[model samples]
Target chain A: MDVRVDRDRCIGAGMCALTAPEIFDQDEDEGLVVLLNTRPPQERRAAVRIAAGACPAAVITLTEQDTSTAP
Target chain B: MQHEPSLTEPVTLPTQRAAGCPFDPPAGLAELREQRPLTRMTYPDGHVGWLATGYPAVRAILGDPRFSSRYELLHYPFPGGPEGPLPPAPVGDMTGMDAPEHTRYRRLLMGKFTVRRMRQLTDRVEEITAEHLDALEHRGPGADLVKAFARPIPALVICELLGVPYADRDRFQGHADTIMSMDAPPEEGYAAMAALQEYMAHLVAAKRADPSDDLLGDLACDSDLTDEELIGIGAFLLAAGLDTTANMIAHGTFALLTNPAQAEALRTDPDLAPRAVEELMRYLTVAPTTVRSALEDVEVEGQMIKAGESVTISLEAANRDRERFPDPDVLDLHRKATGHLGFGHGIHQCLGQQLARVELMVALPALLGRFPTLRLDVPADEVPLRTNMNIYGVHRLPVTWDED
Candidate 1:
């Protein structure tokens, strides 16, 4: 899964960091989204999805690969 | 010919909940959500606008930039609210302002309240909670939890965070009570607000002269926020942080006392505290409603919101929406209540949420653990509710515990 965050849109509610700490963190200076990992492992998918959905500003975006086609 | 009810006919916002159902949102709100998530509504000012009742609709309106939070653009939803268009939000009062201005203040404040920073405050929160519990135990057998326990924990924490002396808590708390009370006359509310602002101004000046290790002190020293803005922000934070969490703690305790099984579930399993906090927040959404005005003509949920039309988003109703939360009325601690609108949504979401969460996570379990035999002193139905205020909570949660 590819992960992304829009710092411009991020209001720093920290929902992403709290929900998916492995994949996201808030920048110390401004409390904006800081993408910690661009591609998290498959095991972290559910958490990443939850984080994306939970973001009040809709700052987090995830691109999930179709597992059905994968070996 | 029978006169058919028009879609534009405004429905007054419901204030009365089902009798004896203290935890529920106002009666008719859920039915309104079921019928139409967004509907024409009449404000207390007699301004016809829209009310968003469903989870999805309220969320959409809050997240959409086209919906303005500007105070001047919106109509008051409650009676005795300021007549005519209100003045623009004061400097640093981000709740009533739109972007750019709101953005700048929010950014400056956000770093102070990041998830990590709040987590770091957990130990402190635990200490504060324990201290309050100690006091409550000393004063009880029977006491008003709202006064002795609920109000003090958050007040002291917020004071410590902002570098305000806890010695001044009674003064500020009195001011906050007056300003937030719907029953207070307009002049009294204004006077209370002015006095609080004056107090904050003095504090801000002190911070500027000698920087301290706290939220306001840091901002005063490090940021370009003017004294006026700092004062506004300080006063705003004090008012914001105090009553909301205090109510949640008091009302949440009230909730647990009434629901013995749920209370037992949490009391036995300390690990359930985190989830219990979220569930309680969802179940008893204290800051019940927020308002937004349309910045421009926009389509929302098949309705066209014309420019400047105000919409009141019922956070309480939204959190209880059956489509979003299954068995919405239940107080189950184990439920996944993450996406609830308890702290609100969008750009102006509560900045102090993480801190509030930390406080609740520490305070609730600690209170229960400290007083395992805690129960309501007054009958559940007899407890006075804060129905008149914009924030929903119990006025005085009279509680008792078994004395050693």
Candidate 2:
């Protein structure tokens, strides 16, 4: 899985970071999204997807690769 | 020559919620959203600007920073539009300020309000809710829920978080109420503000002298925020935290009592409190309308809003648009209430939202659990509504419960 966050657009409500801290963290000084893991193992992908979906600003996006989506 | 548009019509803001349906948005808003998604609105000051009831338009406007939140720059939407561009929001009041400035204060405070930190307070919230519920139960079969339960939880929680002495809460809440009141006497309100300022100034100084682990203390220890900024931030949090949540609890209880089926649903399944809270927030948008001014020429949904022109995004209206949420009028506890703008949205979304959510999540379930047969002491019509205030809610929720 791959993830991206728009720092400029992030108002830093902190929902993303709080939900999936492994994948996302915030700049304490700026309260902006710090995309920690651009790509993560399959185990973390599901949680990251939930985090992305839950973001209030819709700043987080994830793309799943073929192997990642493999059943 | 401009062609005449037959479909579009003028509409003024702040139409009244239909009688006996205090939980729903104005009936006219539903009609307006259908007839004219966007309309030419004339403010009381006679400044003609756009008024939006459509969901998409409101989302675009609130999410875009170009639509400045600077209160002074925008044409005020309420009764009397204050003449002249207002002064910038006070040093620490980040709500009315734009980015960079807003970024500074919001960033400093973000450390305190993180979702994890807020969730950690769930146990504390439960304790507080239990304490209030115990007192309410002990009082009698009939009592004012607002004074007995709704008002105390948020007030105490905020005071504890900000390190403001809880002993001073009554004085502090009084001043905060004055500042929030739309119809209060100007001189009286000004005096309350001054008193609150003086009170906060002393508290800030004490924190500076001896900082602690609380939010205000943490800031006082690390940051170089001046006393005024600290006071302003404290005051801002106090006003925001106290009013919105208090009303939600008070009015939310009223809403549930009137709709017993919904209350029973919550009582039977306590887990439903979270979604029920969201539905209540959407159904009763306490912070009715927010104003924004275009910083540059922007085309939104085919309408060109020129720079300096302002628009009012009626959240009450937007949240109820049937296109977005089917049968938006109905309060469904099990409904997927995510993405609702109960806490508003975008960069300027509510800061203390997680805390607010946790409090409501804990308070509502506990209240219902403690008093299964809870109900309104007064008739629905006699239950006073806060129509005059900027925040829509009840003046008092008179409630009763089975003594046995």
Candidate 3:
């Protein structure tokens, strides 16, 4: 799955980081959103979903990959 | 139409529900939640307001940028009263502000409530809870857990957060109580806010002169925040930190006592406490409702909420929605509740959540461990619930335990 964050819409609420800090980090100066993984491996799908769900602005979007196609 | 009622109505305030202030909503609210779900309410002064009781709609309104929190602090045009505007809302604080202004004020105070900073206070919180438990042990038998246990933990934690001397804790508690009281006349509420601000100003001055590791000192040194803003944040934490968790601790204890099965589960396995705490928070939603105004005309679920109309999001209702929580009424310790609006739903979500969680995670287990066999001193129905309280909670919870 790929995770994307619209930084302009981000308010630096930090909920994204709170939900999945492993895959999300915030710029310390402004606390704006940052994604540690542009495309997370299959095993990290749940963390990506949590990050999406916990985003207060609903800015994070996850596009899932069909694991059956993966090597 | 009447205001929409929260979803917990079926269990907490069923049509045949027992009469009391805490457990049951007032007739107007219960009728609204159960029947209308989504409807317009006429404020006492005859103004029209939207009340969204349904889960999806309320959550959307809270998270939607179209809504504003600023108008919440003003005197609204009510449905039927004097021709003049309704008297200004007595309590005005940061929760009522929005956007750049809100963001600025929030930034000044964020670090204090962050998980990183709050972690340092956990050892102190445990020490305080242990001390309370020790006192309860010495004064064992019948004791009001609310006064001795639930209330002190938050009060002390808030004091530490504000850099206030522990000796002043009682004074802050008094102000907090008045601000949260449903029956408090607007005058008393206003007085409480002012008194709290005054106290915070004095504390800020002290912190200015002599800085410390505490949050208040950090805020005091920040040049970005005005005095009013600093005083306001201090006042905000003082009241929020005390009242919200105090109610949660008390109500959660009451919930566990009534649901002995859950209590036993926690007692047998301490690991159950964290999840159990989350369930308690979801099931016994302390805030119950939060009000936000429309920033502009916005449509949700095909309904139009005009700009400036006040809309209330039922946290209690949303958290318990069967769609989100199967068997919404049941207190399942293991329920995988990923999204509950207990703290809130958007950018303005409760910053103090981590601090509240740490307190509960520690307090609940420590509380259970202290008196595993503790049972209510009075019948469950006999305990008084604080009804119409600005926040939902029990008035007093009496429990008795015998030491081995």
Query: Quick one: best TM-score, which candidate?
Result: 1
The numbered model that scores best in DockQ is 1
- Candidate 2 has a DockQ of 0.43
* Tens digit per residue, CA lDDT, model 1, B257-339: 99999989988998998899989999999999989999899998889999989999999999988999999999999999999
Q: A12-60, model 1: which lDDT tens digit per residue? A: 9999888889888988888998998887877788899999998999988
What's the C-alpha lDDT at position B262 in model 1? Answer: 91
Interface RMSD of each: 0.6, 2.7, 2.9
lDDT of 2 at B56: 84
Model 3 CA deviation exceeding 4 Å by range: A6-18, A25-34, A65-71, B1-36, B72-92
> How accurate locally, in lDDT, is each candidate?
0.89, 0.81, 0.72
Put the candidates in DockQ order, highest first.
1, 2, 3
lDDT of 3 by residue, B76-135 (tens): 322222342324322326577777766665655554455545566789999999999999
Candidate 2 structure quality by residue, lDDT tens digits, B216-335? 998898887888999989888888888889999998888888888888999999778767877887887798888888999999999888898889889988888888888888887777
Distance from true position, residue B355, model 1, in Å?
Answer: 0.5
Task: For model 1, name the residue pairs that clash.
Answer: none
Off by over 4 Å in 1: A66-71, B1-8
Evaluate candidate 1 and give its CAPRI docking class based on DockQ: high
Q: Which residue runs of candidate 2 sit more than 4 Å off their true CA positions?
A: A7-9, A17-54, A64-71, B1-6, B185-191
